[model samples]
Target: MERASRSNMQSILDYTDKDVRELHEQALENLREIGLVNPVDAFKALSAKDSKGRNTTLLEIREIYVSPNVGTEDRELSRIITLYPEITIEGGGQYSQLVLTFENNRFPDMNRIWQILESYGKESAEYRENIDDYPMLQLTILPLTLDGRYGFVMSSPIMWFLTPADPAEEQPRQIRMLIEPGGLQFVQDESYSVEKILEESRKMMASYKMDLQRQLDKEEAEKEMQREMEAEHKRFLESNVTNHTFGYDENTARTAENRRQAWNDMQKDGKFKVGNKRD
Candidate 1:
């Protein structure tokens, strides 16, 4: 008989809108105490506007904490804020706790945003909890409409547990955030039709095929060069051996002829007798 499994499973916490709002506010306050004088003033300086030529408000804020052990300069946080014009600080303290607020309806491409963030430094993934049999959140990078602008949404998956004791009792949920590029607004009227989307897909495939062909051509050229080099090396070795054997054979033939002539000379001088005779 199989032994009973022994495992300790923690209960999942349920996160609500109020909880999220509280956290956001607390994080803002924390940054404010650190050194952020006026977050609103800084945001206004960016002059962020939506499609309707209206000013945008704070849509979301992400808090990034630096390690205490790391000896970072005072300007590092300022540099990070400046690097992303779309982001600003709430308050000032150390580089350890920097609050970044994004403008409303401004969503950037996920890959592009990640690249920019990675350039600044390493970051950790954010997760929230829910209580259900399936995942509470599902994250995806897809096109979406936000505040009258079309952009990409970067989403994260939320897992919900049906039973706290069972490891397999869970479901998936998704939360998404819009990312918009600078100065570009996606109008609903400009949305691609099915035929246009298909055409764009075909063009992308063609471009991909061209790139693949170029790579294959480069590899083939390298292989052909290697083959030529090998063939040349083989020819060189064969030529060297042939020349050495020719010289050796010529020397041996000359030596044998000289020995024959010397024998004939000895016989003519009668120094070496051909037949055995009594003295």
Candidate 2:
């Protein structure tokens, strides 16, 4: 079970509105590529238009928690998400929550239910700022694993967002996977127990963090190297330069002055005066 935001809870708490909007656009583009209906339309159609507490804009999938009962007798696969959506009220107009499921069959392409919580509001710029605010919906998938069993959730290091789709379209588009690490295939290593899976995830996260740190360190070193080079170059120029402009020594300056004086004297010569005359 992968709790959304591996860094997300932090991001949700820290991201500015502009940050949120950028992420929202990315998710929508991804969904469009896969032929998924515009999340905005799907969400609006399924939700009560005038109803309070609707996710009108910006939706971030917090986590994709899949519990594989690897060693236990109960092979139940538990997949849950916090803020799971609500189904539309029948006859009254069924439009409520936006649930994305992946089906393993040709039934409807995918049949797996993903519980998405409503928090983002583009018009209002609203979101669940509190990471712990579990409003309790259809799918409140949390991290879980069994003893000795192991599994891991492959998620984006950079959080993703869903927003109304339309650089030009009037409607909002939903769902996009942005800035994934190497665009690696999404996976959750199987585990016999929730503990094992959680442990595995932790291990993988630690490894990823180390790699990120190394990259940051390398960039810093490169910058430091460049600064040293620039400083050395500047110092060399400063020490080599003479007091006179263009690095001319006092002797060179006197020589140039002498040459100028000679030319002026020649210009004043009586024999050359007539030829030098101009209208």
Candidate 3:
């Protein structure tokens, strides 16, 4: 009896070993036979052809036009909305706006003010992932230059929610939170003028906005297509149902129904349109 038990254990181990080995072999074959596909030609070029470590494709992107500064009286400086860089703040909390100010207590030259602003601007951590953090507002440059120093400020309104409760009353609704009198700072440099800096900033801001808009448009189109596919799937499931004697699987029917509903929704939204405009 002991011998028989030992033989059974050995057989189990052998079978397990063979199955694992076969799975590994199959995975390896799949990897080698299926070459990786680069989603973009630029990525492929970067890995296989571009030797200079430069984004040649990205450099070709068109920039937005900058308008000349018509001065302070002509324009109003209102609070613009800016999203926090990270999804959550450092303490596991969420923030709607963060004020980033540049101070100029060091430099005291008037002519070199623009130069200083440009230098500090370059170092500012205004860039957020995917460029849609402040969809409603654009980053603008300030010109307050004096005594060889210049000032640049970034201002944005914040949005957040607060809930209040009274057992007998409804909970407080969401409110728009804002950070007023946004932060500003001064930098010292004489290389560029305040007008030029502001122009550059506006141009950059416009370009970022355009890119974000295009990306959103593309995503919307993809979502519409997915809805259409789901609708078609639902149709198939409903048409292929079995009677009580040969009952259909509830799980399968539910899945197919979901897919079909998605497709139908997409059709109703008119999401699947191929056009030269997209091109």
Across residues 17-125, which tens digit of lDDT does each residue of candidate 2 receive?
4543543454345335635333233323333211223222212233332223345332222222211232221111322222222111111111112123222122113
Q: Which sequence of candidate numbers ranks them by TM-score, best first?
A: 3, 2, 1
Looking at candidate 3, the ten consecutive residues that score lowest on lDDT are 82-91
Model 2: how far is 273 from its true place, Å?
A: 55
List residue ranges in candidate 2 displaced over 4 A: 1-192, 241-279
lDDT ranking of the models: 2, 3, 1
TM-score of each: 0.24, 0.27, 0.27
Error of 3 at 135 (Å): 23
TM-score of candidate 2 to 2 decimals = 0.27
Residue 109 in candidate 1 has what lDDT?
23
What lDDT score belongs to each candidate, Candidate 1 first? 0.30, 0.31, 0.31
The alpha-carbon deviation from the true structure for residue 224 of candidate 3, after best TM-score superposition, in angstroms, is: 1.1
How far out, in Å, is residue 71 in model 2?
Answer: 30
Clashes of 1: 31
Give a tens-digit lDDT track for model 3, residues 1-279: 001111111211222334434433433343345344222221222112112221111101111222344342222322211111111111112322322211121211111222323333442346555442222222332221121112232233333233222345354321222334432222335454423433343455455456546766877898887777567555444664422113335454456555455444544566533332231
